[model samples]
Target: MTQWPISDAVEEMPPGLWIRRGAPPPMFSMHRHDDVEINLVLEGQLHYLFGGEPLTIRAGEIAVFWAAQPHGLIDSRTGDMCWVHVPFSMVLSWGLPEAQTAPLLSAQPLITHAPELAARIAHTAERWGEEVGGSDPGGTADAADGPADEDGAEIALLEIQAALRRILRASSRARPEAPADGGGSVPAARLRQVSDMAQFARDHHRSALTIADVAAAVHLTPSHAMTVFRRTAGVTLGEYVTMCRVAEAQRLLLTTSMRVTEIAEAAGFGSLSSFYQHVSAACGMTPREYRRQAR
Candidate 1:
């Protein structure tokens, strides 16, 4: 197995709606981001460790998961793959019918084998990678370029949603349901602001981040930012930032041989005690216990 060198870019944060295609990077540290990720295996098989659970996807299979949960490519057989990351906030704003959104929001990935759709998704994803300037297999190019234009971005989003809906349509566990009226729409401005704020938090959580900092990034007052973020995202700004920290700690605990104190600092915890408290509350186990179980 080959472990690809971790780039500084990869260590920082995930970019908005991005696509990349390349040979499988056999080793990856556990990491999470606020996105709905779609992975298409073009050849061979790929194995993953997601939140301590094992998952495998073979050629011609498409797997979609909420990337907010910790996941990584722990191992794999040689293969080419395409990866797509859609900002979760943007996905939420789309008001996708409950049936489509439910499966993505859950911890388990929605995996489907459809060789027919494989070619189409690959072509589309490749085109997206080109537009975003992220076609490099090593993932060195910056994906923050996003779409060349707003129109292009919207088209990409529509196509991705359609692909997901089609996959959901083929699933035995899904049911037909209309999108809820109130849940079906959000103002474009509100969506953009909330997405920006959420993305800012994800990008800066490994620092001394605060609600005010998040609000400032979006040019909104702290009070208004908190209100809108809570209403739109269904989570408090503070809670969201803490969630990011806890996730980072979990990843480091299981994937790296770092001491608990070192991991706490790396994950942006203010103190060792605070790290222990949050990790226990989030995982129902101490850091040492969690690491021991993984071992």
Candidate 2:
């Protein structure tokens, strides 16, 4: 079978957020990550197939959505963008009002129309980029500061919280008409099955797993599970499993000093040859090379 296109996992960075500045690539397949994603479009626009529904964010707009849902960027007219990934745990810790949190959790992106906030967003992105690039020694200093001045991490959290509030206010005031296509035609039961199976695979990818095992987790037969997952997710069970393993391997390679062989075994590869083959195919580089380039 042809391999399915799986989205790469977003690694968690310090301060419980990952920030990047770039244009989003067109996604060949739907992908999900365990983070709350915020996108600030600096130029052009972004088109997304989010949960089988079409959504668009124009230039200068900030859109925030839960990354756990199956979302894909099928097209874009944007040349520049800033992406922020906040861990779900951090989002919860922010204690956002239910009005803002409910929509995000329900797969509804809270889009802001307040152009006034654009400069602040840009500055935040710039500061984060500097910190990640190691241009500022005091970048993480806020993390160690007391409650008064706060650390950089604490300041970031507060800024994000304030942004959410502003977004919530903007959404309420605008009351934009809902999109014509609310979502796709996939039945809820089928979606639940596929989501359950995918969650299972993500949770257990470090251990030995199989299609049958995934099916059993959702109490479905192997054939039924395969059909439902493919229909809803557009990926085969085995392909999804491989994607999970490869993603874990990538994380380990970038963040840890563990030996390649150890990382291979830890990421659920049965043999070194198999690990090398999968990592090379997915990343276009051997493990050592990937680590070097990533670092």
Model 1 agreement with the true structure over 57-79: per-residue lDDT tens digits: 89988888877666667677777
lDDT by candidate, in order shown: 0.70, 0.65
- Candidate 1 stretches greater than 4 Å from native: 1-36, 41-45, 48-62, 65-72, 78-82, 85-134, 139-158, 165-183
lDDT of candidate 2 vs native?
0.65
In the predicted model 2, the residue pairs found to clash are 142-151, 142-152, 143-151
Q: Return the lDDT, model 2, position 28.
A: 53
Give residue 199's error in model 1 in angstroms.
2.5
Give the alpha carbon lDDT tens digit for every residue of 87-137 in model 2: 666666565543444455443467776555654675676665444332111
Query: What CA root-mean-square deviation does each model show from the true structure?
Result: 6.2, 12.5
Instruction: Point out the worst 10-residue segment of candidate 1 by lDDT.
Output: 3-12
Score candidate 1 by lDDT.
Answer: 0.70
